[model samples]
Target chain A: MYGWIWRHLPGNVYVRILISTVLVVGVVFLLFQYVFPWAEPMLPFNDVTVDGAAEPLGTPRAGGAA
Target chain B: MALRALVRTLSETCITIGLVIVLFVVYLLYWTGLRAAHASDDEIARLHKQWAQGPTGSAPAHEGTAGGTRDSGHDGGTTGGADELAGDGGAGDADSTAPGHRAGESFAVMYIPRFGGDWSKPVLENTATATLRRGLGHYTGTADPGDKGNFAVAGHRRTYGDPFKDFPRLRPGDPVVVNDGDTWYTYTITARPYRTLPGDTGVLKAVPEPVDEAATPFRRSGRYLTLTTCDPEWGSSHRLIAWGRLDATRPTAEGKPDALTREGR
Candidate 1:
């Protein structure tokens, strides 16, 4: 079934490949850059702040009962 | 021909963009780490200066007072007429008294004989990572070194050049020396461990209740020294309290340790 579909394709190999590559890149870029950052609060990285000015990088033990 | 060229160009452009992004992130992380380390070092330096010159409170931004205690004693002590920073060793001169030792002065190189030379340096106070890394903290608020209240100091139990890694091994009378370049204040352990909550002001209240009431400080007759760290000897939950009192402060012309000057100086 794949062989028949391949033979019946409208465009040549390179054009099909280009289209597929662009689609995949667009989806991945959208997910990583826009979607993930917006839904960041739901992610595990939310708790890990990479910002410099945050409290000293201390062991969780540094988190006192206070 | 044009389509092939475009694909190759696009791939090259994407690769360059990805590399630049990666480099930028790396640079950011490196910059942050260096800033933290430098700040920590400055804090350690300031703490040493405080220990050397003593807590003058002469300028803003400097915490603690001269010849006074940091804050309180332990978990639950009353604060009536508490001149916690008073240097009660009977020497009235502010400059000569040890109360509120200077922040960063290398008064004494704390030696945990168990950890050997690599683990020794002047202790510091404050929340600075570099200062705490060196193992000294401001004893909240207490009278100056000579005063009649407990002088408290705190440090971390782990990470960023952990200095208190072996502090748990300090037995009673196992010397804790605070050297002010000219003299050494030796403290001897007197109490067993007690639990203190974080943000609990009572612990800094000048008088700490005797865990066993019999061991109380003879109704405020003797000055106290308290060592605070995160409890459990491994992790921080409550504070692990190590109580001590003025063993002796010895004047040294040479590098003679003050622990040897008890009664002779």
Candidate 2:
């Protein structure tokens, strides 16, 4: 997927490099600002808390008291 | 031969630039979060130490008692225990004497059992990047803790410990507790955090609803808490809000309140 995109980017080596750099950064900025945060639910993060004193285990969605 | 060698060197330079760009992305997405998390931990530790060293300049954090600040309303100091009357029964004025609640200062420690028993974050004074990067920041213009208004705060939904990452998981009636100078103010989540536009500052109001200034005054009478973070977890187009109402308050000297007691049920 990446290789194909690299070949299609028109320009001499230097211009191609500049264009690729800009494209990569723009895409990354968009992803970081929007795509990544939106994917938080599907991501495996926030499933566990790092409690140093206790046995590390996954916790259920804690909603109720105690 | 020289031209071929020149071409080879140019290709190497291009590869190097690409590598550098990749590294920059990693730093932005991953390293920055790690740094922010560490900074937050440090700030929390500092606040804890400062509070430990300073005197809690109010009435004891005992139940059903307003520690009698000259300006803090003392009408309903009787809302004590697990049944702290929620509708403005005992919430007092924002303790102005506490230096922590001032802009750039770390005021309180927020504990949400629904997030995790060990999950605690420092609540800073302002909403600046430097402040929010450390922990949750109390919106300066909003009500302070235990006040008869919205004690609104903002935090990073995805980074800087992602303190509110599980905010959506918090259901109604869950406890959202804060430890200011002396009291552990326990609030109950009102409902799942609803969404709103980024410009909607009205949700931070005491009533937790939008209002038009041309129609009515911009304030309400209640002890509410508003937690806000970016919406969609990946974008800043909107906001995700979690609203809670103050339910209980206990003096630090008396030990953890009933809401924190996780024994049988």
Best by DockQ: 1
**What is candidate 2's lDDT per residue for A1-66, written digit by digit as tens?**
345567998988898899999998897777656664444333322212111101111112211101
- B103-132 per-residue lDDT for model 2 (tens digits): 667777888888887888888766655566
How do all models score by TM-score? Answer: 0.47, 0.64
DockQ of each candidate, alpha-carbon based: 0.04, 0.03
Model 2, B93: alpha-carbon shift in Å? Answer: 8.7
Per-residue CA lDDT of candidate 1, range B1-265, in tens? Answer: 9897777778877985786566444433343234434545665466456646743343222112222442233311222233354334443222222333344332234433334433444544333333443455544234334345555566555433444546567666665665544335566776554555444433433565634455453355455666666655444445566667766544433444534333222
Instruction: Quantify how close model 2 is to the true structure by its C-alpha RMSD in Å.
Output: 13.3
The CA lDDT of each predicted structure is 0.45, 0.61
Name model 1 segments beyond 4 Å from true. A1-65, B1-118, B125-134, B210-219, B258-265
